[model samples]
Target: MIAAKNVSLQYPDGTVALKNINLSVKPGELVYITGPSGSGKTSLLKLLMAMEFPTTGTLEIMGRSYGKGQTGPIRQLRRMLGPVFQDFKLIKGRTALENIMLGMRFLDIPASEMKKNATEALARVGLKKKANTPVENLSWGECQRISIARVLARKPLLILADEPTGNLDRENALNILELLVGCKDEQTAVLITTHATHLIPANQNRIIRLKEGVMEEAEA
Candidate 1:
């Protein structure tokens, strides 16, 4: 569902974040982008998500090409993807239920239907008990779950998670991974970027490792 060819990214200061990366991810596949710090793992994800444009080469989402300052095409591409950040970008004052509902704000779903879907999503993340709690009052793990629940509510064609389990304990991290994997289906592609090797599944065949801005097959 996504492809990047000879993609390179450089900052205003001329620091190269990604270098000639070529990669493709298909629907229903769960892939991990693993690499060390400064290896451009996040940069690759940002390009795929259309948050950043590559300074060189091409990035294709679904079928459209994305280039610098092309907000119309980028926004159109993003509507089909759901992103979960490592920082758990939840509104502090909003309740978990509200946070999840925010994902469908662009849709014309009624308030009641939105609430129902949000509640079900929270239940899926084991956050039903904390549905009414403010995000600022939640623990780090709970906030993370809320982030996933928000993505689930969107039902995007592709899911992009960046260090999704970074701040959680072992059990919590496992639960988050399970939720993420469960979200995949024939129409959804899931791509995750993480530094923790243990976070990877043993039977996964789609893992791609990034090193010094290059892509390679992740060893089992």
Candidate 2:
């Protein structure tokens, strides 16, 4: 779950990345953030991930207040989030399974259980067949899924996907969206950001659009 009220972000350069943003995300909910480039899609995500603090107003994520000077708690909160960054930060030399498992090594899961979850995450993303393939050799789409599998293997309570369908074709893009939606449950919430509004599934109902740092509620 996430909550933001009259939130605004202004950098030292005096550029306001977001303005008067108000949002609330609940468990079991799937929300979409659609916007053009430089429209503050990434800035909103940064607020959620605690990468940037609000220049004004209040914000909270997963019940943790994301106020300035809370870096310690924010760092701990990150461990519970499944973030699929726009950039596929895959380890080039590692196998798909290994890359997925690497994200869980510091968690409480046992080694054997970790592998099981990694394998299961890969399968859920339709990449089980490529589990042993080196990440460097996989296609862009495959690498994207691998990045997703890595985050999913963590069993995060909140899933934040930034442009999960960036470079994929229609089929793959929809497949990725389906996988993301299916990952949510009663105790889990999902928030996805993408510039391709057309790729959003027809069933989606909650959408927020941003332009020039201004926020608006759009019918999905």
Backbone clash total for model 1 is: 0
The digit string of per-residue lDDT tens for model 1 on 47-104 reads: 8887788899887889888777888767777768889998988987899998889888
lDDT of 2 at 111: 88
Q: List the residue pairs that clash in candidate 1.
A: none
- Residue 2 in candidate 1, Cα distance off native in Å: 0.5
Q: After superposition, how far is residue 58 of candidate 1 from its true place, in Å?
A: 1.2
CA deviation > 4 Å runs, candidate 2: 67-69, 218-220
User: How many pairs collide in each candidate, listed in order?
Assistant: 0, 0
Positional deviation of residue 12's Cα in model 2 after best superposition, in angstroms: 1.8
True-vs-predicted CA distance for residue 82, candidate 2, Å: 0.5
Model 1 residue runs over 4 Å out of place are 108-112, 218-220
- Best lDDT among the predictions, by candidate number: 2
Q: Residue 78 deviation, candidate 2, in Å?
A: 0.7
